[model samples]
Target: MPAPRILGAAAVLVLSAVILSACAGTPEEAAPEVTGNAQTPTAAAPEPTATPEPEPASTEKPTCETIISESVVADFESLGWSAQESPLYIGSTEITDGLQCMWADFEGPAGDHGQMYGWAPVTEAEATDAQDELIAQGWQREEDAAGVYITESAETVIAPDAEGYGITYLFGEGDVKVADTKQNLLLIEWPKS
Candidate 1:
């Protein structure tokens, strides 16, 4: 039995020696030799190209004059205003060298409220003719420092309308103020001073 024990110990010692011998080697063989130049890092897929920014859209509002002119004409025509008569004619004139007159009128409750507008380049005779026509139609001259004449009258028998015609005369330069009425609608006189 003692002899068998000795043999077992010897076998264990031999196996351990062989394992240690196999593991013992030069540093180059033990760890893989690193080349002088390190491996090039894979270029990060060329950083995905940045998408270009979109251009800004144009932002601009239409001119005020254009809007005003179009709106006035459209409103006047839509209201069934006749332009053939003395007080209802639609006309444009040069008030001054660079100014212009844009005027229009419609049949009023009394008769016709004649209006004259624009840069006022026309002679005083023309202005008087315009005023006279309105005066003949029972439109009273309005006292305004801004050179605007207004005439207002009420007629309940003509139509079941509540409001009557309000004629306004605009001249000089700038936007014209139009009077709104149920029967006559709107009359505008734009004068380019």
Candidate 2:
């Protein structure tokens, strides 16, 4: 081959070799090291936990009166009152303390007025709260009564029949406390004329 051509070919070959060598080798790449002066990303702060509201006190067991015993009915009769064998449900709410009720009425001359007996397996706090509510609503607590806390108003009377028994009595329109328990609430309502 001619000298110029040989020189030109040699130059071309050398350029191609240089380009291949450069492409064949990979450059080392790594994340840059953080220095003391460099600002490192901080972890985000944890969210605040929320506190839950407390639930109201309630009776632990159901206290519904599905059936009123014959003796109980007779007791009403002895008391000069006529009671329904079946329970009648009044409205329910959170503050009732789990009470279910049934009604009894004066059979003869006092027919216009009646009594309501209810029951609930409630916590002590619940029962006390109910009694407190009645007194707060103008129900005068009965004086010197053992085994029961009775209260009276101008047209109503209410009592918790024996502590821890979960039984209550409401007469006339004065009863403001409601029943609360897991059991059905036994309630009675009699309006005054």
Candidate 3:
């Protein structure tokens, strides 16, 4: 009987609390407000700029005609200097594993005056040794650049006359450019050793 009375008291207290809470004032609605200044854009955005590309390095192996200008070849041909067959030489010294392009002034006396252009897998020491050998063999030493060696001839086929010059431009890739100018020939690149 006491438990039933306590249960009834508890139910009455809960009902009273619910009625009081419902009678309480409802909360006012509050809208979200901007925290900072806001505006529409006045102008269009700028387009991004393009960067320029760099030139690619040359990797193509050189050919006899491609090594030198075609105009120069034509000019030499215009003269009596016609391309001759090769056992590639830099004043009678045979070169190996490279290209050779020669031209001789056959119309000249005894077919003497001519030019040679060659590149070979010759070491720097080998080129220097060849220069030394040429100097030893009476070839007039003209210019001696760091890697290039120039020698004039008194009797060598590179320059059988006093007017000619023998030149070697070492490209330091294990090759040397063996060239001369009496009639007219030139070499520019060499193979790597």
Candidate 4:
């Protein structure tokens, strides 16, 4: 009876040792792998977006004639003068009663008379007719540099009663005045009171 009891106790101790050893060596049942289709890779927090910059404003250049024309128009309009269309030309050289006049001021003082050129297409017959008419009217032909037929009369009045097509006069430095006139359709240039 004593031998059987001792054998039973020994068997129990060995079984306990075996259970402890297994627990120590074996890895834990890797917490029930909570795998569900690899949790849609937490969309890496969307990178913060950058704000865009605004565009710059545009700068454009304006022409010279446009400026001069506008200025003349404004000045005349202020003085109650209505402007009429006239032929466009450079300076005031007169070949006929019908001429286009433009003025140019080279480096000079204010109030100084500048060069003027008048332009008109005059046929030989028309020229002869004009000369005869001027002679009849007592306008003496003044001898000038050859090729330029100059006839001077007392300052001809520019009233509505004048006999020929009206004249258009422009005033300015070569470029700026022309630019303004072309742009603004300004009034004719004339002596200011």
Candidate 5:
């Protein structure tokens, strides 16, 4: 996978974990497909049990503008970045009613001048776990007069809890914020250029 895809996958996993945590009941797992013949060459045959097919994935897609506010886009713009509507998707799974935006200086180096932001529903534990996972994955955690921060490199400062988490990767740094209800996660990433 490309670098962006990997980061997207991580974000997706964290989002999925948090959403899973918030659910009152777990979803049913799909049964394995049975491929072999039901009867043997010389044995008396018994009736085989039928297995139900898995449910189809939902076709819903979120209107991102509803989840990502104009003010938030302005915030990035204030920092000299241009907002780009980046839709988030992972194979067949995707976030409906979620936020996916990217900000960048198009003139900068190939992998050095942009940021990405994402938001999705999540539980408190899920949000916390996502923060911990980012730190564990080589991003350093720090606290200062300004606020808490996490960074993948010295030049980047990933702001913490701008309201979830602040995390940055090789390309840029960003933050994550969770709503008070513990039902949403906002992820921000600003790549270096």
Candidate 6:
């Protein structure tokens, strides 16, 4: 029985040596061997891109005073009309990077004596998109020597049978005349440099 136990111990040692030799093998020896000359890349090369052109510089800076010509402001003052500057754009979509100016005859109610003008620092593409969206929203697109006009109208007083209230946007270069629908005869012009 002792002789049989000694033979079994020797057999276990031989099996352990074979297992150790396999465990200590190199990465290449452990991995399955490839049979072809084909090779796989870890990463692909990037495609070439064109150099982007720089945008042209803006020619003017706007402010409440500069937005409206001094002479026009003076004329309005003579008529008891005063202009107010707002950091917030009226009605909606305020231009934080630009100026918003509103002129009104504060002596009386708002009525048709209110006009707003604004200029935002938007790219040409953005302006085009805005114009397109405005047109899609039922605003008519009209072209003229002065530039462009996109307009829509609604009723304000809610008369029994009324026509239009007047909502218009007149723009050129990159400025907007956000007047109160040009409701009054005095139409304001917004300039952008």
**TM-score to native of every candidate shown:** 0.29, 0.30, 0.45, 0.25, 0.30, 0.47
Over the stretch 88-118, how does candidate 2's per-residue lDDT look in tens digits?
A: 2322224343343444553456443444445
Q: lDDT of model 1 at residue 149?
A: 54
- In candidate 6, position 154 carries an lDDT of 45
The stretch of ten residues in a row with the least summed lDDT in candidate 5 is: 177-186
Give the count of colliding residue pairs in each prediction: 8, 23, 4, 17, 18, 0
Model 4's TM-score against the true structure: 0.25
> Candidate 5: misplaced stretches above 4 Å?
1-97, 104-114, 142-149, 155-175, 178-193
What's the residue-level lDDT of 168 in candidate 1? 47
Residue pairs in steric clash, candidate 6? none
Q: Model 4, poorest ten-residue lDDT window?
A: 175-184
Q: Which runs in model 1 stand beyond 4 Å of their true positions?
A: 1-122, 156-165, 173-193
| Candidates' RMSD to native | 21.5, 20.6, 23.6, 27.0, 27.3, 19.9
Q: Report how far off residue 172 is in candidate 4 (Å).
A: 22
- For model 4 the local lDDT of residue 100 reads 33
Candidate 6 residues lying further than 4 Å off, grouped into runs, are 1-60, 87-92, 107-112, 154-165, 181-193
Better of 4 and 6 by TM-score: 6
lDDT of 5 by residue, 108-181 (tens): 56565555555544444544555576566665665544334444433344443343333431211232322211
Candidate 3 structure quality by residue, lDDT tens digits, 20-97? 999896864444445568644344445689889886776665555555567766777788676655555654677765
- Which portions of model 3 miss their true places by more than 4 Å? 1-63, 77-82, 90-93, 104-114, 142-146, 153-174, 182-193
Q: lDDT per prediction? A: 0.43, 0.44, 0.59, 0.38, 0.47, 0.60
